[model samples]
Target: MPSAGIPGWSVIIPAYNEARRLPAYLDEVVAYFEGLDRSYEVLVVDDGSSDGTATHVLEAQAGHPAVTLHRLAVNHGKGFAVRAGMLAARGELRLMADADGATPIGELKRLEAAILAGADIAVGSRALRDPSVTRQVRLHRKLSGEVFNFLVRRLGLPDVADTQCGFKLFRAEVATVLFGELETIGFGFDVELLLLAQRRGYRVTEVAVNWADQPGSKVTVFRDGPHMVRQILAARRRLARRPSASS
Candidate 1:
């Protein structure tokens, strides 16, 4: 079990048509956090999954009380689901991770410790060096990641290595403020959120984390890749036209 102190955390998992995997993933999340000293709650955001994803989550509630379900009647993007969950969460620390379990929820300590040390936001990064470097990503995905990171660096964001990592934790104050400024509902949500955080002058820290590639991936590489690039450019224009925090 992944144990931590009392009043531990509020975890959010956003799912879109994940009926096949939500059953087991939710179980692992709840069971792993069972014996912790922390009082935690898990909110499953069913992002308009038509294939009985909400039904499965509701059925599982028969066994787990700490888990709650929030259904968005329409399919909103990942960012919208996460923003809704985080804003509703009442924990001292708010966490929004993926339903895929690519990054184990247990390793949240890396981010938690960063927040405890005064960072407002702490995000996971598989892009950093480690023994599992090669296993972190496949060739094509890795190539796409490098290109995106290069552009992000060129646009003035050098501290963030992996903006798309599913694992991230934020203090309540930070979550409330940043989630308010979020507009993108798609794949580029992280990039905009990070850029907005920088605009707001929040101390966002990136922590390297353990990762295991899982199947049933949702990102459409070819389609979303171009769309993400557009988002980055749009974000740049938004920042340039809007007043920055330091300004």
Candidate 2:
């Protein structure tokens, strides 16, 4: 059994209609944390999934006390779901991972190591080329991602290579502060969060990790791309108006 008191880690997964794709990943996450002695909690936020997503998490909770479910009344975007989970998380280290499990749960070690090394935020990147990291991405998705990232750099966050990676680790305090102030409630929230971190003078590091393109992606390059770009621009304007700590 995990030790009593505060949990060492909180894994927040934002799921929307992920009944078919989430179960295996949820089990994998639970199995991974079960082997370790440290305390951890998995908060699977169901963004009003029309399927049995909430029911599945409830059933898992019966066997694994650490697995909890937070259900939204209506389908909010991934960002809103993740923000809810982050704010509700009680662990010292908070991690937001995709329900599709694009990045393996084992990769948590790399981000965890970054946090332990004094970084405030550690983001998993598929853009960074590392011999140890294996990435199996679809050609079309790869090209679209490259184009989108180029825009992201040109607009803001030139320092960040891959802002859309769903795997990110943050210290509890940082998670609270960033998510609490978060305005973007869509897929573009990652860019805004990183921008806020930069303005807050927090340390952010990108680590290459193994990733594979998963089927049944909710995002469409043609449909959601423009929306994401608009959200990023709006976030930039809003943040620009607000004075940073240094100011």
Candidate 3:
């Protein structure tokens, strides 16, 4: 439930040089939320984009007052941008969405249902095979994602099928706790977040959602895959040093 004057949902978009790709998604998000009766906000966290990303967001804000822009001083990783937005959001439910809009904003209903049902965190998964869920992914990207998820399962978070998916919804307090303790500031941050959630006994539900591989993606498997793997290993070591809530 949202406090008085506070929005029920906050969509957090972490953008880095996404001027060419973000506008359409922003419009889609605004349109979807406008149809609903509940109050909502869109927080676009510009990750020091040299492009006109911030300017575009400002222009959108002129039209839609619910659209807010949070500019980062320097180009940090996606994890850092999302953490900043999550911490700054005023909504009861915070949704972290990719700027490229791989998953349609309409799919938010599925994650929201999971959260309303009982989950503290609702992760949108592309790997889950649900008759109602559809995924159109490239072969290479799909293969790489499978291999990476296998590594993730071996490391930890075995229950989560798609740990790298950027679409995830978190309850207000859950977002604060998980992101406040976040250390992996790169692409592999999702693995660490799930690990921390598991350690703290948060109810995380994986929901199958419709996803499509969009053009102009920031991640290149061949280039960033190894770096993400290293980050995951580093996060494991860091968590190993920390005591769990039960401990």
List TM-scores for all candidates, in order: 0.92, 0.98, 0.97
lDDT tens digits by residue: candidate 3, 1-247 = 1124889999999999999999999999998888888889899999999989999999999889899999997998999899999999989999999999999999999999999999999999999999998889999999999999999999988899999888999999999899999998889899999999999999999999999999988899988999999999999999999876650
Which structure is stronger by TM-score: 2 or 3?
2
Candidate 2 accuracy as lDDT: 0.93
lDDT of each: 0.83, 0.93, 0.92
What is the per-residue lDDT of model 2 for residues 124-144, given as tens digits with 9 covering 90 to 100? 999998999999899998999
- The residue-level lDDT of candidate 3 at 66 comes to 92
In terms of TM-score, which candidate is stronger, 1 or 2? 2
Error of 2 at 8 (Å): 0.3
Q: Ten-residue segment with the worst summed lDDT in candidate 3? A: 1-10
Off-target runs (Cα >4 Å) in candidate 3 are 1-4
Q: Which candidate gets the maximum TM-score versus the true structure?
A: 2
Q: How close is each model in CA RMSD to the real structure?
A: 2.8, 1.2, 1.9
Candidate 1 lDDT, 200-231, residue by residue in tens: 88998888888877778888789888888788
TM-score of 3: 0.97
Supply the TM-score for candidate 2.
0.98
In model 1, pairs of residues that clash are none
